[model samples]
Target chain A: SQQGEEDPQALSIQEGENATMNCSYKTSINNLQWYRQNSGRGLVHLILIRSNEREKHSGRLRVTLDTSKKSSSLLITASRAADTASYFCARSPSGNTPLVFGKGTRLSVIA
Target chain B: DVKVTQSSRYLVKRTGEKVFLECVQDMDHENMFWYRQDPGLGLRLIYFSYDVKMKEKGDIPEGYSVSREKKERFSLILESASTNQTSMYLCASSLLGGTNEKLFFGSGTQLSVL
Candidate 1:
């Protein structure tokens, strides 16, 4: 039940354009994390945003958390063909629980 | 970098066969998890262990079991493999009880149940 929904199940963008994905949860969370998975590969941790923090940035990635709306968004700046991958948002509901992930947003960066 | 290694990158087994997927972490993480990823369904946690000999059921743990007899090793066992059980299995480890800690995942094993 702690699982969230990722908006825009799939997206297509140009190589130099930006891409954004959203995740909305049904319950309060301690922290939210974004992960990227290449085709047929395991996920790579991108960034983590705590409930108290409104925004966090790491290199080309920016993550924003809106606790009031129980939603979070991940934005990738200047996407590349290599950036074509599925992105998932995971939430740690409580200290004792493991992270629950969303279905993921599949992004296609055309070169 | 933390290394969580799943024993096999790909596995094939017949229905009703006993299967064991092994995972080892070199980072001395206190928590380990087993998850199966499926299309449209995302990643579903099957089991997790916080300590040696300690196991907890996740969202979908019916057909899978796990063991953590050693601090660095975690294993997922399938009593009898089924066709529906065919999926990519991911192993991950993280620090002890910290919401801020990030999970490091293995390359994953794609299991094919015939």
Candidate 2:
């Protein structure tokens, strides 16, 4: 069971700044997903980038996957104060199995 | 919209007591999972069920058991609650088939064992 490991345990930035979080996994994957959790709340799915895809965008969120490196990066552009949350990356392995999540990076967006 | 719901948002139980955490999904998802989130441990899978009366142990299945008697409902039972088991419990559901599908998570249950 391989799990995605996100870098930078915690990050803080001002409003309107861009925030980037990276994730790395050990094995082959079908897809990678990014989720955001507000304080004391369940995680909400943000975006998913397939293994073959290089980059994807949804609103202010952008995800890039590099299968060669087994790494993925999630970029939230023009971060808002409301964007303060814990962002996690999960990887779907090659088979029909559960997605494995990382410890996540706590992002604090200051106004 | 797909929704996964946990029966309780918070629970408090004494050590040695039996604890039951229930979850239900509105969508007829074929897969259901139970995960515990801790401060530094991230989200560790406790158990997963792909069908009724079917279950699979996950990374940290110790002291945890699951029942999936119904298609939409799954239960995580703590035979004997322990202090170390106090953590946020999350239930998630996903459609069957490709592994690339997204998972829908519940609001979560914060269980406190005294």
lDDT of candidate 1 over B16-103, digit per residue (tens): 9999999999998999999999999999999988888999999999988888999999999999999999999999999876435788
- The residue-level lDDT of candidate 1 at A86 comes to 96
| Separate DockQ for every predicted complex | 0.70, 0.78
Off by over 4 Å in 1: B98-100
- List where candidate 2 sits over 4 angstroms from the true fold: none
TM-score of 2: 0.98
Clashes of 1: 0
* Candidate 1 displacement at residue B101 in angstroms: 1.8
Provide a comma-separated list of chain B TM-scores, one per candidate: 0.96, 0.97
Candidates in order, TM-scores: namely: 0.98, 0.98
Q: Rate the local accuracy (lDDT) of all candidates.
A: 0.93, 0.93
lDDT: worst 10-residue window of model 1 chain A: A92-101
